[model samples]
Target: MSFALYLAIMMTGDQIELVQESFAHVLPAAAGAAHTFYDRLFTLAPETRALFRGDIDDQGRKLFLTLAAVVDALDQLEKVVPVARALAIRHVGYGVEERHYSIVGVALIETLRGALGVRFNPETEAAWTSAYAILSGVMMSAANETASVKHVVAA
Candidate 1:
């Protein structure tokens, strides 16, 4: 879908602006927030911890960089959805399930709130929620499609 069409269907301009502004405030402290996010994620869903076979620090950096790309592309979701879908398919190989997305989203918002302190308001929270939902939904759908293809090929 086109940018305008996609935006109308899900996230609004105001929500995008809120997400951009809130994330910008926390970007400088992203490393710490990344750590916090993973900590929270692991705590919330311990079973998901095994998926991180690599260094936590390295994984955190990649996560933040990917998040930055997603945030930056909020105005042009068409540009970000493909990347999100690709990442989702890759995640399936890492043993990441669709349910993990919600845990990560909560952890992410909590990380931002902790990192940003007073800057993380209700509006910002709502925006991030909407943004993450859109991104995760695309990724989950792609992952499911990939799984279906694999099953068909195997059969």
Candidate 2:
């Protein structure tokens, strides 16, 4: 399944609503959720831990804050594209490869499941999955473009 087709099929008004609503539930425990997300990410991809330099807690906070902003802008996704692109470019500098996105997505879903518990139903999971897919897709595309440009310049 191509990313474009997946986005077209999975990202709908109802799914957006589900993601927004489910994320609202995560806000109260956002700190914990962030911690869980990082923990899961490191566990899933231990090598990726080399990408972080400073405090894990601080990084987690930034993660949640970014996520909050992204969730708030879901209805206007275009508004976040530039920000995501810049972030992605920076991530490329941090040794983040394209495959790390999938590892991060799995960690995100697990974090949501742990945070939402019973509230994280199949529909909610699907919503968050779609949202992550869309966001990561944009980031990965931007990263790839940046890498290509750098390669061309280097060559």
Candidate 3:
């Protein structure tokens, strides 16, 4: 999809349906989707794979379990974002670069489409893409802002 089309959807506010569709139609797929996603993610970024301890497949299951727990408590994003932000800061220790976000996004979308099967229509696809964009942008910005503040404090 063109950037123009993405912007048009945002401008027209037609995406609320998409968002609702996600919370309704897609939430069930999230756990399986995330497991598959991290599999491909680790495969593509083998160096980062070492970040996981013990059995790789078990680690993937544990990951989806944690995310599912958080999704169940989505209303408590104050807790979620703080934990996420702290983990993002720790990504430095894992050698996760900002560029890895794109790879992660790709695996995520692929996993969603795979898990959703026939229900992953074009509109759903667009919505997922939009959601990922917003997620990635926010996460990267937060990480960057934290990094800047830390830099200033250290200096």
Question: Considering every candidate listed, which one attains the maximal TM-score?
Answer: 1
* Residues 31-102, model 1: lDDT tens digits: 888889989999999998899999999999999899899899898877887898899999999988888988
Ten consecutive residues with minimal summed lDDT in candidate 1?
Answer: 1-10
Task: Judging by lDDT, tell me the better candidate of 1 and 3.
Answer: 1
Candidate 3: tens digits of C-alpha lDDT, residues 80-123: 45555666776655666788888987887777677777877788
Q: Given candidate 1, what's the lDDT at residue 99? A: 87
User: After TM-score superposition, what is the CA distance of residue 70 in candidate 2 from its true location, in Å?
Assistant: 0.6
Q: Give the candidate number with the greatest lDDT.
A: 2
CA lDDT of each prediction against the hidden true structure: 0.87, 0.88, 0.62
Q: Model 2, range 82-124, lDDT digits (tens) per residue?
A: 7788899999999999999999999999999999999999999
User: Candidate 1 — which pairs collide?
Assistant: none
What does each candidate score in C-alpha RMSD? Answer: 1.7, 2.8, 6.1
Cα shift from native, residue 40, model 1 (Å): 0.2
Steric clash count of candidate 2: 0
Error (Å) of candidate 3 at residue 14 is 5.2
